[model samples]
Target: MAEPAPHGTPRRYRHGPCHCDLCRAAHAAAARQRRRDKAYGRYRPDVDAEPVRRHVRKLREAGLPLPQIAALADLNRSTVSTLLHGRPPQGVPPTRKMRAVNADKLLAIRAEQWIGAAS
Candidate 1:
């Protein structure tokens, strides 16, 4: 169990308009912890994702939205958005590199789609 707030601190300054030093320090520390947690789970995509990037670029050029691209790529909309916007992939642990298998699979799907489009 934890000790209750002193009945005046207002619980880390998040509740209302308190500007006390304690609240400010607590808020800053909480912000830092949030940032660290976000970074810790960030997944760095392959810098050399040219093949998939190019494919995604073309699909975007064709005016296909993220959900459509994701459906065609057989991936999640978030994954397609990360590839489309060139953001680092998220939701995977930083210690594990983004899976090459997924990228390769996208490339293969892109090729298949292109071939199908031609015919």
Candidate 2:
């Protein structure tokens, strides 16, 4: 048996992505909790869109095609095109919701790319 953690210390390891029925139930429960947190606006992602925008701009500067950037980010061509060239929504009367698809993941992917480049 593993030794217990000190008081106020977080668990080093306990539950994880395992295949047993109990582990699967735990995984499902955690996922549901995450979804609920997101729905309730209680979860804030660590990365935002600025890094993604910077990375895309760099790629564009290097003359990479939109399709290439999209592939690198695991985003669709339309999304990469939109990210690069689409004007920000503005209106005196109205416009659509401001959510940018795949932006968060793009940020994460770009950060990872930077790490890889640095090393």
Candidate 3:
């Protein structure tokens, strides 16, 4: 008989005696990804960039300056300016709604750039 998990407690995996290389690597990778996501503020890749853009636009239409808009949006002033000027943010690529897909695409792009530079 299995012990009942405490209220609102998540069940732990019971991969008893299973110290496979693949599982270990997967766990390590997951931990690394979590750290990277936290460090890079990559929490939500597909956070509807349109909403942010629209917010900036509305603020601009309301006569707010670029700096004010940036402050309100918690973004850089140049980013707000670029968006107003119909340009994407520098250094960061466009993101899809699916976070995993967006992250994968970003990683792939970075990898390609690194490989190209090394070649």
Candidate 4:
């Protein structure tokens, strides 16, 4: 026989097909958290990428290479490359949205700082 599902888990309420009190409470709590997150504007974790793309272009124009820009922005090298050149072959467009935290990080970099440092 299969082992019984653990108590106090939404998983038990869902896949376990168990509707016991603990499972129901867990499911309700999960639902409440989701509702609160949505109400607090935390549900959408991404922002439009256009502004970050523009900033990257500006930084490039200021003579900062892609790798350097990635380093300054504390982002992945591939992430900056993909933003500028897109994927290979099909050359997929830069993603339409990026995580809000990444966008903020990239946007925080100032082109003038690099331009001054490069000189």
**Which candidate should be chosen as best, given lDDT against the real structure?**
4
What's model 2's TM-score? Answer: 0.40
lDDT leaderboard ranking: 4, 1, 2, 3
- TM for every model, in the order presented, reads 0.40, 0.40, 0.36, 0.60
**lDDT of residue 71 for candidate 1:** 75
Worst window of 10 by summed lDDT in candidate 1: 89-98
How many pairs of residues in model 2 come into backbone collision? 0
In Å, residue 33's CA in model 4 sits off its true spot by 11
* Candidate 4, 38-88: lDDT as tens digits: 999877567989889998898888788888889988887877877777666
Tens digits of lDDT, candidate 1, 5-113: 4323434376445557777777777668667867997543444565677766776676666676677667766566656553334343222223565676666654345
Error of 3 at 60 (Å): 1.0
For residues 1-119, write the lDDT of model 3, one tens digit per residue. Answer: 22232222121112232335655555566668778988999754444445445554554565666665455445545444544453343343432232344223322332233335447
Better of 3 and 4 by TM-score: 4
lDDT of 2 by residue, 1-119 (tens): 22333222122124222355555555567568769989998865534445566767776675666676677667656555555555344212211222344665554444345446547
* Model 4 bad stretches (over 4 Å): 1-44, 116-119
Off by over 4 Å in 3: 1-42, 86-119
